[model samples]
Target chain A: MATNQQRDTNLSPDEARALRFDVEEFNTEYARILDAQDIDAWPDFFTTDGFYRITGRENYDAGLTIGLVWCDGRPMMQDRAAAVKTTMVHAPRYLRHYNSNVRVTGVDGDGTIHSESNYLVVETLMEEETRIFQAGLYIDQFVREDGGMLLKSRDCIYDSLLIPNDMVYPV
Target chain B: MPDTPFIDDGSNLPLSELRWPDDDLTRIPDWIYTSDEVFQRERERIFFGESWCFVALEAEIPDPGSFKRSYVGDVPVIVSRDQDGEVHVFENRCAHRGVEFCRDLRGKAENFTCPYHQWMYDLSGKLMAVPFRRGDRGEGGMPKDFKLEDHNPKKLNVTIRHGVVFASFSETVESLEDYLGPDNLEQFDVVFKGRKLKILGFYKNRLQGNWKLYHENLKDPYHATLLHVYLATFRLMVAGQKSAMICDESGRHSTMASAKDDDIEITEETASQMKSAFREGMELSDPEFLNYVQEFDSPWTVTMQIIWPNLIVQRELNTLGIRHIVPRGPNALDMYWTMFGYDDDTPEMDKHRLKQANLMGPSGYLGVDDNEAIKFLQDGFKHSQDGEGIVKLEPEKEGSTQTLISEASVRALYRHYREVMDI
Candidate 1:
């Protein structure tokens, strides 16, 4: 069983390394879900009270603006999925996500893991062909749940100054 | 040649020339909407030469060392906040070899370093460092005559009003207020409302239609009632409301406005389809979404302000935003929509704003319909080059109080387009 000290802010060296590995795995799985267009499964990765945001790197760096997609809880994410799947009509396309350079920054007092990673998404459409849709960094916070680690908050800060195309899906 | 009063000739004019014929009301010349040469000329003479394009809101870069990279026409630009909190707009290209300097979209950095050769620049765009300047070889170093101060990106004339920032490539363009004029300026202030802003998010999309088509769509109130039945179903707007589409002093800017008529009743058939979760009788999830909060003394629930060239201040229901259109080619345009709410919104109000966000964006019910309509319209134009499209609704008066079914705003846009493009 994990000790109270290991669960809280202070972690043994071995536990710290394990927490880093857990965050890296979470980042990879999250990207996989989005890239696969596993729309239903995407929201399950978040905690009940989670924040999911996708903002321009410019806005995040300046620390003065909000995201393009800002959701404070899982219900907002679920609502977004329902709308996109049922009501919205868009050109058919496939997305490929590439995430790398993941690093666990630290673990907070409540066993929440803070991590960051870099990402690039390439989208292919009928006439436009495959192009760089967006390239950015993700600043994330994860909490240990019953089954696995769930994302408490995730902020995707995109570096592509000019969005190559519409941001229809979550990053 | 004598100055051609920018009229329509109603004949086979060169793609470079445009003429407005007195007989034609709805149809415009095909060349104006579908010519590559015309687009190139617009980029040269209009976007890159004169117009003041919106770069970023001042609220986005409130702190020192903050920066964002954007575009003016097709030209890459960087809007930065200096140590003193002064905002500046400069060309994004490096002075050395014309490479783009700031690759990242945004960040707070005391200086920017060019990745190509390690030439560093301060936030003020002044050259700060050169990595190999005093090398061991000394012979392969930069020349002694190469001055750092001379390498700053070209500065542009900029203006800020109600926290929104505007920049002009031409130094002699009219003042921001004069450029917007009274009719459109008032609408801008009403939506922006001089408050410190908390940017909610951004929605960027690319349309295959000409940029003007989007402008025409916004100016045309005709489609809102028909193409988007959702509006009528929700009783947010009705076909019998008193509305007007007015052009600004320059005729380049316009406002399509209509007040809410509470007296108008929603039929049972329409109301059943729009039964919102938050309130049964209320069309929108939030009552504010239906409320015209009246920050200003305007008598309109909806004010769509078309700033000349690209910026649009959209004040619809409770959603307030700025739409910036970047023309990619004759057949394509990229739209960037920045959503904003005031700094003082309560948690519940913020939630309300988020829920109403559904009214816009790629997945938005209204926005998706507009996107589909714009594409179909472009397809129609592409297939039918021989026939003219009609814009002659409400012909009795040149500009009249708009009906829910009128396309007068579209006609006004073309009239203004001819003047600016010297068509």
Candidate 2:
């Protein structure tokens, strides 16, 4: 019965603007790494105890815990990265990740930044036409690390009712 | 249902025209995967025929007046709990003009009204009111013999066993208990043993392959230790483990049961047989999620059951779910997955289930491979000439077998499929 709770942010306009820019930069690098299929480097974007999950909006709205992909910690995420890179079998494909409308929602007392963004992933198989694979929202929490931001938690809530086939790469 | 005929040539390519590629169940014809005529007959002889199809779990619509849109073999239907708390299943198609009225996937509705003409129906699908029954102050009214009871949406016979709901178009179809047969019923009860279930979530995806291929996939355990490298590498379900390809009396139903024998090392001979699947040194960074608590009263750690025409009961270690296969056409199917857990599970147990969830769904470590492999099977037929696919493993046996390297259950399935489909 996990749920995304609403939070009220009371950030100064200048502070909010600066934090939003940093989040946008973080997402840019994150998407670049994924789109390039550098799956091994995917875990570097997260904290040591980072949480990651990709669940359908229907499940999210219903407050259900089951996820298409759920990683409790950075170790689990690294395990997933390894599996996708070597063990898991799938078709050879190219993916493009587009993240936009980044919104810095709140800054926690522990310096954790709550944010959300719209994401769309388009995929192309060998000799097949490209298609919209997923359209979703990334509800995230970021922690400042080494003067940059690292994702402490990311819950990708996809809006597509039916995934065309398999989501080979992480969103 | 709009019966828009795809081929005007006839009513189900005469049984004589469609033949099995071999006398025994060694080879499967390519046309069976690519022919539209066979698809039409499946609709008539299998789906709408005398078979109990899984519609929705009672947990989905737990409250009175709650309804969830589901399908019984590609035919859209609404599974509703009436105000009296009785469950009902009826076609989503409006009795008035054939418009699929139940658009929402799930909700609590006192009654349903067709948007096309505002033809209202109660939660039990009894036609409550017709928009112009008396016709605008009696000006252009009906002939007055239009009975609400007679014009209700087609209803299906529903039977529930331990909160698992099944609906059937055939009134004379055997009870769900008998239909599942004794062996399949025993495997089924291991999961649905009268415990209250909490629905975890859902995953819907379309597989670009025939629906039957999915049944074949689970029944054919020969591919499990090979295609799914993660399973083989992690010692989850490798060869030489205590496994069985079990089929019910009807052969259409089967359970691929296997116990995790992690203490036993894979022999060098088996390792060579596994080839690339047996990764030499790969390991999981967090192996705690692979924990298997002895929750069920069964010996097997995995029990993947294909319940006849539509349902797949998956109980792989701690992860539990049911996959409903909705055949769209000969080449594709829509799989609706509903993951669940016992209501009495602890918070830690819940977290463990989610962690293990990565092994199943569309992006699962194991499930993704099966989806891709089935797609490859369909693609091969689409691109090549009419040829037969071989299913000769454990060729001597035709029903159940005790070894992992046998396709006996798959052959058993085709044996029953041929009889039911009359191909």
Candidate 3:
């Protein structure tokens, strides 16, 4: 469990380290599901009211509202999942999401943990060389529900300005 | 003079080698995509020709001193607004050393100073200052004959229509209204109807195919019903629907317009053919984004306008955007997408626009398919040389058509292309 500022004041260094480890575990599991291409299970890692968006660092820094992919809630995420799985026509490819530098940045009064990590997604298209698809920071807010951590919001802000071709899968 | 008669033509092949396959618009040679010579000629005769290329939106550089980095063909340019509230388009290259000095994509800059030598340029692209004009105490400096006016960066003739900005390299280029023609200009005003625009955001991508293919993709509306299942299944745009591929008199510009029918439903067979686990249903769990609000006075719900050489005005349902095609070479292009909405739009309408935007851009549901198809086309041309693509659908018709099954617009584009390239 994460701790708020009031609770964090009394938390020992070892306890703080454990909280970070927990967040890392959650991120690792989330990455595992995404890299596995399990689109159906992808939204399960998020709460029902989760806000997910993938935007360029330029737009994020400039306070632009649009995103490459924007989902206001889990229903929208499911819709995206269904669309990508069924109707979208794209080349067959494999993606691997590498999440690192996971750190619990802060805790809200209601025990909502804020964490961020660097992510790099490498994709290998059919008969094409593997390339770095996206490199960005995952600014996330997590909340625990029913003894499990789920994303309340995930903002994938990519520093790689120009996307090569099209991004078939979400970051 | 005869000793140095052989000169660099920017490509290995001479101009004579590049010629149209025949005096027809149906057959397109593959060399147009792969040949460097054709690409070079296109840059000179078409991109930098008399066409009015889209540079920036007035909303982007709305205030005085606001500038945005853009491209007119392959040339980097700065689209800036002067203190007097006039827009200017100038080459990004520095006069001293030819460095692309405007590094930032967009910002408020009083004057542009080259980082290489600090040669200063004002908002209107006039050379206003030279750091070492008389040297540091008159030791090392530019020659006394050097004049500030003589070394200004190359500027372009700018024209704005309904807040949409266009720039041209030719001094005597015709008016934008004449360039777009009556038919195309009528459609252009549908989106830019003198209302103020609010910049939503941008989606920039490097397409791994020739720039012209992007134009052809939109102009070739036959593939719209077949290639994109999302559009077909949702009945947003199908072959049976009411649509038209309207072209300008010159055949250079076109508008592929389509109206959506709400009652249309996906057939069970089409749903079963989808290779996914969730084949039982095709309806989206959240169809809020698919709801279209009647805003524009035009009959068409979707209008994709291809304006000559480098601009694509995309109005898919309510999500409006301008796709600026910048040719990197013959093989690839950098597509800069500027998504926007009217400034008077309510918050809900704005969110609806953003929600609907998922159907376009680099990562869009329908957009990914076109990108992949284009890549496949480029690969086909690269791997198998000396082949010509056939665009013979509705061969008798040349310009605008009522049917969606025809490739008349594609043929029209090539007709104009051949005239400009003079091949």
Candidate 4:
């Protein structure tokens, strides 16, 4: 009889380890995509029906508030990417994200892998020197899919209480 | 040192002539934003004067002896429930030396003890105990004539309606109903509904802009569709919806409401095109996006209530929220947004709310854009001697119902603002 873990269709242990590496690669690629200002490629990392939200830990822990950016489906995410890229006018700056310490926290009975990682983003603006923009941990949930893994949800909990400047793009 | 040429005092500069055209408010006097004197006067006349500020909801302090501490303008206040089940609000300062009496954000406390001298006050704002009061030898302690009754913190006028709590510094301020106005009162009823509330969470962010700018942002509906395109792309709000900008008789409170499209007819050709281009009809990985269950009594998809001075109650689709503005300085304001769902919401609905919660908060796709925009406005004002941004979007109309792309409500806000400031 296939046990719950065996019955599940997640990648094998070795494959899962490799999948983690794949996720790291994906995270780096995602950051690069944002840095490149190629918003169209940003939404491609998630599943079609994935969830993406940017919320402060204060609201998240209190369970009393919503986030600034909430995208439940891929279309919504795509729509946000399109809108911010084309319509919004913001001060020009360059953001460099460093995502590390990727660890899979748990694997649910349904083969959903819960993971977390620490990240720091440094932003340099025109006529200003580089500064630490934000540092936080990314709490994410992933599901196995054909050919690769798909992100089901991503929650970024920033450690920096004060945001130096406005958050215009995805972290 | 004899007859110095008579220099003219600037008082004759014709201040009214300096005012921008009655229809336009874009070129506001630099004195409005940068004057320390004006800010101090505003603090006295508005924040500490006649205005009903929303303090806390009944749900926050439910049981007797439960208490929550918040600020009314800049004054720290304690909202507590007494043994008799009545709620009372008092300044959170010890009357003796004006030390902060309550330190906890929220808790069940029988009485608040001042750490400075150990003076105690009950939840009812009555002096309860004072340490070493009766001198052992009847010599050294609180003055023999010191009376406990005289040391109670100042109590403000308070009123509760539909589970929301409001307090005012001025005794002569209008009643809650009068303050909320008729149109906004009806909208409040729709969201609050007298039901027991469940607090979902709280989000806090500091906007580097004047507090007035935040109020104007909420009142100005023109930016909604353009700034928050997530609303349009997801069909949460469309350009063609029937929308209204409503204000109270006093013009202090405002409501921006819009109904979603119930009769959206999609032609087969368009449907096919949308499906192919964006995969519109595909099932969301999380089904919550497709869930638009109307739990509130209102027909509108979103109702953003801008209570005068510094409170906003937002009922957006499934997410219910309250935003409180705390001003740190003339240029910086802290925003505390609390999102909520009713206690009776089912697990599915709760999940739906949590999923939809992405629409608000500091990181919210819509909210972040607003924060960025507010900062941009502040930054723009810093370099320019002109302190005010033009808000003359729709000049012809008054008393709400302007075009979707106009700043009429912002004008209304400033109109009431000038009344309070008496500028």
Q: State each model's C-alpha RMSD to the native.
A: 7.7, 3.0, 4.9, 7.9
Error of 3 at B44 (Å): 0.5
lDDT of 3 by residue, B250-275 (tens): 88999999999876554565445432
DockQ: which is higher, 1 or 2? 2
Give the distance in Å from residue B251's predicted Cα in candidate 3 to where it truly belongs: 0.8
Best by DockQ: 2
Per-residue error (Å), model 3, residue B176: 0.3
**Tens digit of lDDT per residue, candidate 4, span A1-171?**
000112233556786687578779878887898778787888888999898876655545555435557777788787667656644446688888899887665678887877778888888877567888888778888887887777899877766655653567787
- Best of the two (2, 4) by lDDT: 2
Which ten-residue region of model 2 chain B has the weakest summed lDDT?
A: B1-10
TM-score of chain A of each: 0.87, 0.94, 0.92, 0.85
Provide the overall lDDT of each model, using Cα atoms, as 2-decimal numbers. Answer: 0.71, 0.89, 0.86, 0.72
Q: If both were scored by lDDT, which would come out higher, candidate 1 or candidate 2?
A: 2
Per-residue C-alpha lDDT of model 2 across residues B194-219, encoded as one tens digit per residue:
78999999999999888999999998
Candidate closer to the true structure by TM-score (higher is better), 1 or 3: 3
Each prediction's DockQ against the real complex: 0.17, 0.66, 0.54, 0.24
Candidate 3, residue B97: how far the Cα is off, in Å: 0.8
Q: Each prediction's TM-score against the native?
A: 0.72, 0.96, 0.94, 0.78
C-alpha positional error of residue B163 in candidate 2 after TM-score superposition, expressed in Å: 0.5
Q: Which stretches of candidate 3 lie over 4 Å from their true place?
A: A1-12, B1-13, B265-281
Residue A145, model 1, lDDT: 89
